[model samples]
Target chain A: MKNHFRLGLFIFITPVLLWLLLLIIVPHVELLLMSLHGKDDMGRTVWTLANYRNFFTEEIYWYTFVRTALYAVIVTILTFLVTFPVAFYITKIVSPRLSGFLTVLLLMPFWVSELVRVYGWMILLRESGVINHLLTSAGLLDAPVEMLYNDITMLMGLVYTSMLFMVVPLISSLEGMDDSLIEAAHDLGASPMTIFYRIIIPYAAPGITSGSIVVFMLALGNYLTPKLMGGKNSLWFTEQIYNEFIASFNWNQGAAFGFLLLALSSLIIWAGLKISKQQLGKALS
Target chain B: MAPVLDIQHLRKTFGDFIAVDTLNFQVEDGSFFSILGPSGCGKTTLLRMIAGFQQPTEGKLLIRGRDMSRVPPNRRPVNLVFQNLALFPMMNVRENIAFGLKRQGVGAPEISRRVDSLLERVHLSGYGNKDISQLSGGQKQRVAIARSLVLEPSLLLLDEPLGALDLKLREQMKIELKKLQADVGTTFMYITHDQSEALVMSDRVAVMHNGRFEQIDTPRNLYSNPATRFVAGFVGETNILPVRASSSAPLQVQTSFGLMLRATPVGNCQSDTLDLFIRPESIILTPAESHEDINLFPLTVQNILFDGSNTKLLATVGQSDHELLVALPQNQQFAHIGKGDTVPAGVHVDSCRCYPRGGS
Candidate 1:
């Protein structure tokens, strides 16, 4: 009877498993296969390790990989700094009516596509855009300020786009926290700053961790922001893959770049999980 | 000795609805004081105001002779054991106990000594490193006490601290709490809707109703000589009989039981309308032939129930509108009285109190 029940459960879950296998598992496996295989002049498949070897030997490729990882980390940190205070205000300080209005206002920008949001940043930061126009009119600048097509703009776009992800989880975790704990800490003679660092931060650690992980992953995989904002000077790893596949038509090189980004993201996720497990064990024990 | 904490005309209102109104009391030092009422009677609100968690709309609250109306909870020399305990889940038992000491900038060795001493005091010495979730309900209760007591706050507020425990555990904790309080000598302000818990644990209890304190007195005083109809009815079971003051005698009430009960009138009232209160245990069941006084009434036993230590009887006195719910000791034989048996019910007039109707 148990065997039959188990079989029934497996049958019920088979479709979802098949969808994952087809869309996610298969594509990743194909990417790995392509990374190992070489392409001929006519785009025919051939076996070779030349692309991987070339990638290891080149400084630019390794630099791009490191730079992208660094960009993602910076974006994650900046997003958290901005989002945590806002989430806290919404959850604790503001009146419910005002908070609900502010929540809708914060989420309004998210309704638009990430591509459009990036374009919005481009318009604001461009040489002849509103910021430059304001500066020039105010006589702060003799010419239109050259703000766009740089790493700063790219980082700004990534942070803005991924901010909502951080805020939602942070608000949820903070909202779930018992207010009595804070009051108890105060009754114990803790100052406001002490209460924040010792009690509030530790209580909301799970939200912080989960939010950072999401922001980091999203920022790392993003290609549009760097491409649009950084323009020709930008040397993001995703751009390198884009150049290899579409511009250069080098599928083998593109596959190698894809594999490297995948490996770096996986390493980060694994490290994050390890730290989370350690913190969780400490919290539980 | 001076009052440790004094609240005068304390009132709190949330928009149109009043939570606590015109509450006045003085808590003596080194004494356990309780605010007892049903839920929504503002007992917890009163405690919260005392702890500086809530500000009264109108009142003066003084702690140790200093006005603490504007003082915040943290600055006050007081600690609260929250109803849920609210122990720091991330910290171990020792860490939780040491938290307050650390906040006060106590030295490491002193913090350790205090934590260990508190753990032993609460009878959980070896469980210092255990996680909060690992401890049972009773253990959690002890940890909460240890954490609050370690701070050595002059005043400690407990909001139904043992309310979550099972009956047996709650009973045990009441005794443990009293012993702990005796050892520590901290004035504890406890809040509970459970009258028995309040009666067992407090040196004095203030009964609250409809957001105001009805009366404040010792348990025995409040039970035996309640100032209001609500207090008399709420503290324990009381049989309230509607009465009309007769012009024939001063302090004499005409009850429906066909007798003029000579009872002490509560408060000043010129009207004849009053409510006379008699405890169920105060009414004596006797044989009709043995009836002794004019206060005796002939009644028929309508029902009898065996309630563990006692048998509760439902008796009707003549053609009265209300039936009497009387409790008799299980061992006491009652003249072979069963359902439909005639009996004489003697109410001790001295034990009955007369109060103005609805003066609560």
Candidate 2:
């Protein structure tokens, strides 16, 4: 009976495994193959190591990559600062029904596509938009101000769009924790701030890791936000990949760029897992 | 000493649902008091109110005669060992024990000294760096106790602290807890659904039913003289026979055990319908032919069970379909008794407690 059940489960999972191989694994392999092939004038594929060499040697390529990574790091930090208190409030302080309603309100923006959401932010942040209009009318500014089409606007979009993802996991992890632990801490005479840093933060680490990884990955790959809000001169790396593949028609360079991004993300993920394991091991010990 | 804890009319309500209804009690200094009840009987809510995690809707909680109804849990000089032990999983045994001292801003050397002393006190010497999850159930329990006691709080509240332990371990810990209380000379207010656990360790037990305290007394009083039907049925084996007050002297109880029991009123309560409570062990079971001059009723034994030290006899008394559970010593007296045997059951009326029926 157990064998039959196992067989049935395997049969059900086979198609999904096949789909993952075809969609995810196959595309990754094709990218690796294209990265090994050099580009021609007619955009034909020719075998060479020039694309990889350029990625390693060029300071501009490295600069854009480093810049993109730093932006993601900043966004991750901002998201952490903004979302943690909100998650804590909803999970630990508020009534369940109210928390549920607030969570839904937070997630309501997710119903719209990222493209539309960025455009919406662009509309509000433009020089002639409501913010500048309000500022000028309130005598806070002499004329329409320039805030959009900069690094600040790009960062704002990234942080705002990813806030809910951070909150949802954090709330779950925080809520899953026993309320008695906090009471226990208080009973031991720990202050609220001490309790938050010592007990609550560590308890919610898994959620923090998950939320950060997701937000970091999205922020790292994001080209649209910077393009729409940061404008032409900012030059994020994912935009470089887009230009290489479509505008410049350099498949090998684009593939190389994509591979490097993958390697960087993988390294970060490995570091994250290592840190999580070490901390978790210490907690366990 | 006067009572270290005095809670008067402590009521807590959530919206329309009353969690605790006008609970009034006092804990004499350096005593083990237990609140014994089923789940949702407001025992935990009452404990939380005392701990200051919860504020009662009405009434006052006094610690050492100081009204602490509005005092926060952190400010209150009381500690609680949560049911799950709630040892900081991140910290080792020594760190967890030192947490309270650390919060009080004790110097590191003093903290180490105190933690080491407490570790020894709880018989956990050299387990300073042991992980919480790595400890056994009983060890965790000891760790929790050590952690709570290290603060030297005037009062300690334990919420079913032994509810998760195995039977033998629970029994062992019960003795250890009572000893710890005696050694520390602090008030312990414990909560548990286990009646035996309550009776074994508590200096006084308040039996809670619904949202009210049914009775508060010592273990002996609770078992030998339960004030209400709820208390009688909850604590131990009890046969509550429906009876009537024939007069003031002899109660007329048409029990399945036969005849009006010649019993006197236990208290001054004037009520017609009475409930005669009899513990199974209190009754004498003998063969019908050998019994003489006893308050005897002929019962046909339906089932006989040998339970190591005692023999349990399930029998039909008189013509009623009611079955009386008779416990007999598993010695030579009941060695020959088996199923389908007829026996005479006798009750010592003096030992019975008569209460007004349905007086809850």
Candidate 3:
């Protein structure tokens, strides 16, 4: 019986293990090898640290890396601030039917491709777009104002694209909270703000960590939104990696940048876990 | 002394369904008052209104002679120990107790002092640093009570706080809660669906049914002199027999089972059809030839339910086939009483109460 159980378990898990090993682990190992090598004078690949050193020596590369990290952090914080109340309202305040409807509304935008969605934002945000036309016609602006190709536009696109990821975790966590806890806080003479801080925030910490991690990773590695919205000034880290691999045909340099981006995301997530005092396992669950 | 919490004609309705209907009551200062009912009987709705969590559709709630119609829960001088004992999981025992004081903007030293003293009062002196999850069910219950009582609210509302505990723990906490209420001397408005908890813990209990209070009295009076059929059935174990008054001569009721019985009429029981409530323990079983003066009937015992001190004898009255429950007291004389034993059971007229059937 035990042997049969073991065979069944192994059979059930073999496909996932094979997929992970072949598709993810193997490629990452290949990239790691490629990142540590450079083309020699005769065009033969040889081991070197020059590819890794190039990132630190180039001022624009380092600046773009820091800018992307900072932008991702800002977007994560903004998404949290915007999504927490929306999640709370849906889970606790609204009727069940309305809450279900609102959840579907949040999910509706994800049905279309992320590329299509970013392009849609471009239409509404560009200088000659629908928003500018409406503003000028309504006498809100004398001329069409340039609303696209800026940091704000890039951040807006990042936040909008990553909203559903943040909200899902938050709603699941907030819905598990008993309403009586809020009432108990109120009864104990805690004001609304105190209740939110002392009870709701602490109870939803795992959800916050999980949501922030997802949003930050997506925003940091995002290529399409920043490319379409920020135009020339959008020097996101992923865009730099894309340029190294596709534009410049520097596979070794691109592989190094990919590892660096991976390291940066891991470091930030680790710091976030430390600061919030939440375990990654619990947060993900 | 004036009442601490006075609710007059308070009602709560959702669309067409009424949750609470014109609930009027006053909880005395330093008294443990419980609203006891089955689930969805509007007791919780009434308690929420008292705690200022929900607004009454009509009528006013007064706390310490001040109208609290506009007061929100946080502003009201009341705190609730939730049914689940909703202790803040993020805080330690001391922090949980000190939460209300901190919210009140009390000094740091004062907050610690009060938290320490409250912990001592709840018999959890050294558990200040212990996480909430580490505490057992009863300890958590005390911490919840301590958290609320530390606020020194005019009234403390306990919403079935012991409902989640196991049977043994629930029994233990009943006495603990009553003692805690006495030690704190805070007026408590407790709502629970458990009849035993209400009867054992509260100074007075209001039996509620169908969005209204059927009777509000001391536990003994409620058991002995219930005003409604719902109360008699809900409060304690009693045999309710359908009967009709032969005549209003102080007390005389004819049972529907073709047996004439005697009872003390309750309230304005002028109606012909009535409900006769006879406590099982009130019936006296004796040798066949020794019964005289009192209402006696020969019964054949069909079943003997032995439950320690609460044993009961189920029997058929005379030859009428009407089932009657008679409490078997713990005594040497009735030790041999078993199934199929024919004995004479005597029921005193005053031991039985008759209420007008389905009458308000």
Candidate 4:
């Protein structure tokens, strides 16, 4: 019986262990080694801090990096504000059957690929697109105005793509909460607004933190949305890393930039957890 | 003085079903009032309406003589201790207790003072900084009560808050809650399905059934003199014998097993079919005392339920299916009586209570 149990455990764990080691751990280790070295004046392999120094010394690289992080934080906050009411409506404000239907409605957009959904938005928002044509014909606007290739459009794409991640966690956490808590708060002379901040938000903090972490990571690491929507004006940090790797064939510099992004994003998350007084372990659970 | 809560002609309907049917009651100032009923009996609906979480379909609810028909729950001068206690898991004991006062824009010092005093009242004086999860079940219950009481609302509603405790804790909390209510002097509107809880705590209890209150009287009166058949059956353990009322006397009833019993008459009971209720304690074991014209019959003991003070004997009529529950005398009066022993049981006229049977 013990041997059979061991066999079952091996069957379940083998693929996961192999996948993590080969796909994630091995490649990341290789990249960390690659990131530590750069070519010398002698045009041979050498170890140097030049690759790391290049990031802080250059204004565009550091500014774009900071901009991307800030944009990601904004996207995460926007997604949370938008998804909280949607989650509350689904879990508490509606009947079970209606909430089930509403959840399906929210999930329907995600059934299509993210690229396809972004392209769908692109088709609507571009100049001479369906929106501009309808607006001009209805006399809401005199001429077609360029709406794409802007920071706002990129952030919108980022928030939209990250919304489902925020929503699922919010819904699950909100569902686990007792309705009596809200009622009890109200019974104890708490107004609706007070209850929202004191009771609902605190109860759903773990969900919010987990969702924010995911949304922030997704927004920062996103390549397609900023490139396609913001066009040439987009100075996303990942784009610069991509430029270093594919355009210039600078594998060492690309690896260094990649590690920097990873380390800095993690540092930001740590600072955020400290500021918000939430433990990552609690949020993950 | 106006009652703290006066609910008049309150009715609540959901689609085709009525939850609370045109109910009228008044909870006096500084009194402990309990609405005792089984689940789905609309006691919860009535409590929610009074708390202002729900609106009555047609009626007026007055709190301290002011109409509260249009008021929301938060605006009402009331608080509720929920069944599961609903203590904020995120906050410490002090924060949970001071939540209502904080919402009311009270000063920080005032909130702290009230919370501390209230915590002391509930016997958790120095444990204000402890997390809610750190407290035991009984302690959590006291915190939930202190959380509500700190607001000093005109009325505090408790929705079976003691139902979640263990049997021993429930028994302990029952007495503690009664004393707490007496100490606080706030009008308590407690809702529970536990008959003993209501009888032990409340100054008056409203026995609800089928969306309406069948009896709203003192606990003693409600247990001894239930106004309706539902109340009589729901309040306590009783042998309800379906019998045909005899036209020969005003309160004479003949059971289906061919036994006739006389009861103290109720006014204007004109129905021929009635349910005669006899409490288990009312049935006296034979060979003890002789009485004036009481109904006596022989019963075969089937089983002895030895539950300490509440021990009872399960018996049936001689060679018949008429079962009777006789409360065993705690004084060892029937100590020698065992199963299959034939004993005579006597029920006095006053002990036999009768209510007219209703239609299907």
Best-performing candidate as measured by DockQ = 4
State the lDDT of candidate 2 residue by residue for A1-285, as single tens digits.
999999999999999999999999999999999899875788776788889999989998999999998888899889999999999999888999999999889899999999999889877889998898899999999989878888888899889888877888898888888988899998888888989988999888878888888888988898788888888667789998999999999887999999999998878766876966634333222
**Where does model 4 sit among the CAPRI classes?**
high
Ranking by TM-score: 4, 3, 1, 2
User: A-chain TM-score in candidate 1?
Assistant: 0.89
Q: lDDT tens string, model 4, B13-120?
A: 999999999988888999999999999999998888888888888999999999998889988899888889999999999999988888889999888888888988
Candidate 3 CAPRI assessment class: high
| TM-score: the better of candidates 2 and 3 | 3
Candidate 4: stretches off by over 4 Å:
A1-18, B287-290
User: Which stretch of 10 consecutive residues in model 3 chain A shows the poorest summed lDDT?
Assistant: A226-235
DockQ of each: 0.79, 0.69, 0.85, 0.87
lDDT of 1 by residue, A1-117 (tens): 999999999999999999999998998888888888986788777888878988889999988989999889999999999999999999888887898888889999999998898
User: Residue B87 error for model 4, in Å?
Assistant: 0.9
**Fnat of model 3, as a fraction:** 0.93
Which tens-of-lDDT digit does each residue in A1-285 have in candidate 4?
999999999999999999999999999999888888999988998988888999989999999999999999999999999999999999999999999999999999999999999999999999979899999999999999999999999999999999999999999999999999999998888888888989999999999999999999999999999999988887899999999999999999999999999997899899989988999999999
The TM-score obtained for chain B of candidate 1 when compared with the true chain B: 0.91
lDDT string for model 1 (B94-131, tens) is 99999989988899999999899889899998999999
Clashing pairs in 3: none
The weakest ten consecutive residues by lDDT in model 2 chain B span B286-295
